[model samples]
Target: MADSFSQAARAATNELRQLFEPTPLQRNDHLSAQYGAEIWLKREDLTPVRSYKLRGAFTAMAAVLAQRSDQKVFVCASAGNHAQGVAFACRHFGVTGVIFMPVTTPEQKIAKTRIFGGDNIEIRLVGDYFDDTLAASQGYCAEAGGHFLAPFDDADVILGQASVGVEILDQLGKEPDIVILPVGGGGLSAGLTRLFRETGAASSFRYVEPFGGASLTAALAHGAPETLESVDSFVDGAAVARIGALPFETLKNVAMEHVILSKEDSLCATMIDMLNVEGIVLEPAGALAINALEQIKDQVKGKTVICVTSGGNFDFERLPEVKERAQRFLGRKKYFILRLPQRPGALRDFLGLLGPHDDIARFEYLKKSARNFGSVLIGIETTSPDAFEALFSRLDNAGFVYRDITNDDTVAQFII
Candidate 1:
């Protein structure tokens, strides 16, 4: 079975080569030095659609076209990379594709998908959420007699994704000591695990998921794929509410200890570090494995580690948000609701309480016409983590009433 899966992976990869060259597997000297490990990055973000989604898209679409010569239409639902992948594949195969995207999807993504598909695909902005868009697409697929290409659930898609593992082994010319993969629907993790298992490669696996959407962790705990009550969509590429049933079959054996849940805000710091230090623009999902390195620093020391950098379809518009999140996670920034007395020197007193390196980023008075006091929302950025301690101490010493909403997600959600 391993041999056959290996062959299938190779064949699928070979077929894909006709469309575009394989994504590079580059060694990172900086990460290697930092972790005391030989770190390699499987640069799947460099794909034609800027994601690994294309491999699955092509493999699934090709199988459908081969099996049913009469089927000329394909349908899929995605807010980003997956949609672009299907679009590119549809154009490559000269087939018509209808892509359904959530109305809330960024315009940059929708435009890129359109550009990739050109005349071969039509896009529909239907629902506000992915589930709604998926339902609409499936309904259309059924009504129009078009083939539906699942983003990660299908067997063919998993097989296609396995090719990444094959490429890694071939490129590195040796088995990596550790393979760190970011999990979304479990397709990539499932495919890679199967490939390694079949090939008998001795690389241990570490799965990383954004803490808000730890579908893989939930599944492993429940012994089956379970739907999450809510998923933070910040890590859009790997933020699935549920793991795919087909993918979970292979991933069922994954040890909970091997799974790493990355905090959404901390992941932003990793992104910033990569961008500033490595000049890599990683979307939140793409930063997962790298961010997990923070939690497992001791385990990977002096080992050969491979981090699969997934998707790079990030909007520059979100850079400020990412920066803010990163700063807060690093303790270099804080937000608070200060109750300021309605007096002339109150603002000056609060300003005087700030340390030398502290900078005011946001100052919004919630109530202008209060009788005696006003609720002031404030955001402060400091030079170092310890700077927050000094500033907070000063605030307390000065007897100014303030509520730190820095770690308060509920309060931060509304004001920050």
Candidate 2:
């Protein structure tokens, strides 16, 4: 069965070539040197919709349409790359598509979906969360007698996503020693792992998921698909609450130890690194596999490894937040609450503690009621992590009372 599926996936990949060339499988020199390994990145970020979602969308639609000639209307629930993929495919096939996205989804993604689908797609902003939006889309599909397209989970969608694995092996002419996959709904990871196994490839697999939305980990722990209570939407593309049932069927036997979790903030650092060093813009989900490389550096040393950069639909508006998060993760930035003596020269005295390279990014007095001292919120950024040590040493030597709030998510959420 797996062999048959692999053959079908290969055919799907061939058909997909007419839609867009295989995404580049380029060697990343910077990462290779850093990890002491041959690090290659499968550039799914360079896909026509800036993601590999289109592969699954197109392949699933085509597979379904191949069997039934009368189905033309398709509906899907996605606020990110999947919507764009379905929209683009809808336009390509000249079919009507209805996309349901969360009300809180960024306007940029909505606009891109519109651009990809053109007149072939109609997007409707529905619920505040994906679950609600999904329910609404399914309800509409049932009511209108339209075909419902799942983002993942379905066998056809999984087969479509298998094209990524097919492309990787074809482009590299051989499988790498290790394949790191970013898991959301499990479509891509399941597809890749199944294809590789069926083809007798001996590559080790590492699954990475956002720490805040580790549905795959949770499912592994429970031995079944499980819904998370809450998910941080920062890594919107891979932030799935529950692993898809069908995808899980293929991924069920993956050892739990091979799955890695990446902090959302730390993931931003990898995004910054790729953008600054390689000029590669990656969405939070796209950076997951690369960000997780640090966790298994020993295993991959002196070996050939591949990281699938899933998507790059990054909005420049989030650049500032990404940089700030990256700096915090690297210890190049700090935020603190300072209790300053309410005196004429207090501000100047506090300023003297900063090193030459340190610069204040934020400073706001939180409380003015204390006649003896004032509570101050200050954020400092520096070029090197050493600057923070010097700045803190100076503050300690000067006997300044302060509380570092940089790592306090509760307080930083509002102030930082």
Candidate 3:
């Protein structure tokens, strides 16, 4: 079954060539040297939709339409890349599509998705959250007798996503020693793994997922799909609460040790690194596989490896937040709640403890607690991480009682 699916994927790849040439398989010198490995990035970010989702959407829609000629209307719920993929595919096939997105999805993303679909698709902003939107889409599909598309769970979608593996092997002329895949809904990983196994490719595999949404690893541990209680939406593309059933079936035998978890903040650091150092603009989800490589650097040394850069639907408006998260994760920034005396020279005295490298990024007085003291929220950024040690020492010596709120999730989330 896997071999037949992979063969169909290969044929789909050939058909896709007519729509868009294969995305680049380029050697990344910076990443390669940093990891001591010959790291090649399968630049799925270079795709027409700037993601591998398009392949799956196109393949599934085409296959479905071929068998069921009367099924022209397609419905899907996605606020990000998947919506764009379906939209683009609808335009390609001259079919009508209805996309349901959470009302809170970024305007930039909705605009891009609309542009891709043009007149072939309709964008509907439904519920404020993804779950609500998905339920609404499914309900609409059932009521209208329209075909509903599951982003990653359907076999045809997986077969479509397998085309990425086919292109990678063809472009490389052989399989690499390792293939790193980013896990979201698990369509891409399932598709690629099936492709590798069916083709008799000997490449080892590593799966990376956001720490807040380690659905794949959790599913692997439980031997079935398990929905997370909560998931951080920072890495929006990969923030799935539950792994799809079909995807889990393909990836069930994967060793738990091979699944890597990357922190959302740390992923921000990699995003900044790739953008500033390599001139590569990647979304948070796109950086997961590359960021995980840091943890296994020693193991991959002198080996040829491929990292799948999942998507590039990043918005520049989030750049400041990304930089802040990166700096905080690297310990170059700190947020604190300080109680200072309410005196004329109190502010000056508190400022004296800060080193020359420390810059005040944010300041807010929480409340005037007593006649002599006030609770203040302060955010400080520094040139080097060592600057924090000296600053903290000075604050201690000055007899100021302060709480580091950087990692305090409750306080940070509510106040920061």
**Collision pairs in model 2:** none
CA lDDT of 133 in candidate 2? 96
Tens digit per residue, CA lDDT, model 2, 340-390: 999999889988777788989988999999999999999888999888888
> lDDT tens digits, residues 1-416, model 1?
34487788899999999888878999999999999999999998899888999999999988888888778999999998889999999999999999999999889998999999999999999998888999999999999999999999998899899989989999999999999999999989999999999889999999999999999999999999999999999999999999999999999988899999999999999999999998998899988988988799999999999999998888999999999999999999999899999989999988888888999999998999998999999988988999888888888888889899999988888878
Query: If the candidates were sorted by their lDDT against the true structure, best first, what order would they fall in?
Result: 3, 2, 1
What's model 3's overall lDDT?
Answer: 0.93
lDDT tens digits, residue span 1-416, model 3:
34587679889898888679999999999988888899999999989999999999999898889999888799999999999999999998888999999999889999999999999999999998899999999999998788888899999999989999999998999889999999998999999999899888899999999999999988988999999999999999999999999999999999998999999999999999999999999999999889989889987999999999999989999999999999999999999999999999999999988888899999999996678889999999998989998998999999999999999989999999
lDDT of 3 at 212: 94
User: At residue 99, what lDDT does model 1 achieve?
Assistant: 97
Cα lDDT for residue 58, candidate 1: 94
